[model samples]
Target: MVQYNEWMKDVNDDAKLSSLSVPGTHNSAACHVALPSVQCQGASVTDQLNHGVRFLDIRCAKLFLASGDDANDLQVIHGKFPVKIPFPLKLAKVLDEVYAFLQSHGSETVIVSLKQEGQDTWDNDSDEFPKVIWENYVRPHQDQWYLGSGIPRLGDTRGKAVLFRRFGVKDEQLSQNLGIDAHWWTYNTTDDDRGEIRVQDFCELNDTNDVQKKSDYVKQLTSQAIQYNATNPADPKLFLNFCSGSNFFNPECWPEKIAQCMSDANIQDCFGKGCGIVVLDYSEKDDYKLVKELVDKNF
Candidate 1:
């Protein structure tokens, strides 16, 4: 029951820990152990003076350099949603890890909160929209660029990323001191400059002629590279599933198509693309089921 709220309390915490990551602690030749870290909220803090440290942030982390005015300030870290601990020990360990982690990353503020209802908070990534655009638009550009011009395709590096999680929260009046929003968690790929093709985009009313044209173009491009093909990827009767939507979610709508495509392409990690895939299951103190459904539906 150490009240780490007292800054001094953290002094005697881990002696060998204090100089951690410093020249005294981290030697290039030093043999670091393989133990995992204890994450406070989502940040990994030091436990027993650091043998290991890392946590799964939103798979597609919103990585932008810190801005001015706040430039001197640490990158403020806050949950876009919420997370909670059923056990005190678990929470305490995470706190310990977060403390150590702050120094490692220049993050200024780290907020822990409870999950909320009716908000979009998941990243269901798939390849339909961009596939449509790429097959039709980008491919043509590539061909023309190669044939008689000089232009660079920016690729998917535009930072159009995604993140998603399922969690719960309690319902209460705002002023009641309810510990609801204090621990919400989310990995933010919130917006995009790159035209990130979303799952919803695939549902848009595309012209039948355009779809056929693009489909035909795709067939021509991959025909020699891939001898086999699937035209009606999503024939109403089939259902497909995967552990992740990868960096996007449009694929969920036509799961069978993706599975078939992956098998054809011989991808090692079919759903593991973009940043990295991690499923974090944390909750708040409230109606678990209802909150989760609301969050899932809205997000």
Candidate 2:
């Protein structure tokens, strides 16, 4: 049996972060009570981390208030709605949780994929999004982060959080130090090869009938990652295969519904395979079978 909290301890330090199989949660911090369309995850960040989830998909929005108090603060959100109801969840709090987890589990490294979402209310042209992240969140805790542009070895990021930046930076110097450069890619794609990373983020489902297509795409990507690693052991590109989708208006095709369909799809074939970082929705279902399967691959 594998220990979820410290599974990385058994992995070789020389292994590249891109070459190993990793479990991840999509919209990771959206565990609070919210509308079905907004809430994508069930387990909290700490719970996910404790259950072998190493990658996190965090979407942040700039909260520019009328009074300008805490204007620089970033709120965790999903689409247009705040992830946590009654009280807003801040990026600072999420980082605190990650830092605490890393402090106790020194052998583990968390990959945080931060995307700037919900910019309809504010001007998107303003480069304040990346600036705020760099100045307020990252720079203050520089020592705890792996701010490199290339894929890192497991040893280099054991006790730190690796940044998978999804937003662009205006300043050239700041951009260089903003960790892995995954700023842009083809949206709603099944597969888009970008040299360093190959992504399969086909999120929008036209109807419930499209669920099977989504599942097939996920399985195909998983097999591709495994094959890529076998042939290119020396230098493997990260495969971010997302097993999540939704049909916005159709209640039958919401995130949970899609997750259930994905769960039923024979994912056992992916076990013990190099599936890169498999990002999922509602990862706590079926006693965390998905997380366990992905983590067991590393051992």
Candidate 3:
């Protein structure tokens, strides 16, 4: 398995994350620290308690692979900070593949971006995330993988999130699906009554617009995660679970408010600085994947 280790941290609220920082690692994608922008580059990290994660400049980023399956050779691409940086061509290709694969999975996840909580120019709307989502809105649907997780951070949580936008969206149909605003990707290709269904199929099967939908799904999933903890306060019960704000997908953290209350009683990763904090139920994505499979097969 490709285990990702922390590289380094400098905790800067100003740096725009450029090339000089990463002189060694082949940069493919660089994420802006939604909270505390660190100044360190690629430093091998494993300890969960390391201040590196809390370095909070960027959420998660990785260098693209070498010239193999994923290669583009692009000069530089825009980052979450709207700053252009060098990315190995091969790495960009890998990101594109990951994006496609995620789209195909159709699972939802609410990303607590570690980037600075400020507006981004690339996004024209009121805020960066909403703006980027509005134009690139990929409305979440039933079968998509993104719908899997979405929730808000409790207590003194940090990090901001942008619901990644989707393309090839329809107006009314999408509106009905998400119970949110509807905006298509410009023009429709066909005019058949079943066009919406066909379009959905295309998006799901080809994974072309998978990133948009998956990103949206995650936003919604995380935003509403507190519901899982919706147990009666009078009869409060606590379950030994782990949470680092990412516990929205944890099984015990379902139903929103109930789960939040449950998490409040247990341990927390201390805003991700430490790791022994139990939120609701501590598990990995596979936990939900199994649940999703069971639900698909049974109910």
Best by TM-score: 2
Q: What would the per-residue lDDT of candidate 3 be over residues 1-299, giving only the tens digit for each residue?
A: 11111221222322111100110111112222221221112222112112112111122212234242122122122232222233222223323333343343222111211222212222223243332232332232223212211211211111211122222223433323332121232222211112111111111212223333323332232222222223322221211111222122343322222223323432121112111112121111222221122112111
lDDT of each: 0.21, 0.88, 0.22
**TM-scores for candidates 1 onward, in order:** 0.19, 0.96, 0.23
lDDT of 2 by residue, 158-264 (tens): 99999999987767887889999887789999999989899999999989788989999999899899999888988769999999898779988888988999988
Candidate 1, superposed: residue stretches over 4 Å from native: 1-92, 107-268, 271-277, 280-299
Weakest 10 consecutive residues of candidate 1 by summed lDDT: 21-30
Residues 1-299, candidate 1: write the lDDT tens digits. Answer: 32212212222222111011110010111112211111212122242112221122221111124343222211112222122222112222333344444444321112221112222222324422223222432244332211111111212101111111112223233212221111222232221111111111111212332333322322332231111113321211111111111212243323223223323333222221111111111211122221122112111
What's the candidate order when arranged by decreasing TM-score? Answer: 2, 3, 1
Task: Compute the lDDT for candidate 3.
Answer: 0.22
Clash pairs (backbone) in predicted model 2: none
TM accuracy, model 1: 0.19
What is the number of residue pairs that collide in model 1? 31
In model 2, the Cα lDDT at residue 85 comes to 78
Q: In model 1, what is the error at residue 225, expressed in angstroms? A: 24
TM-score of 3: 0.23
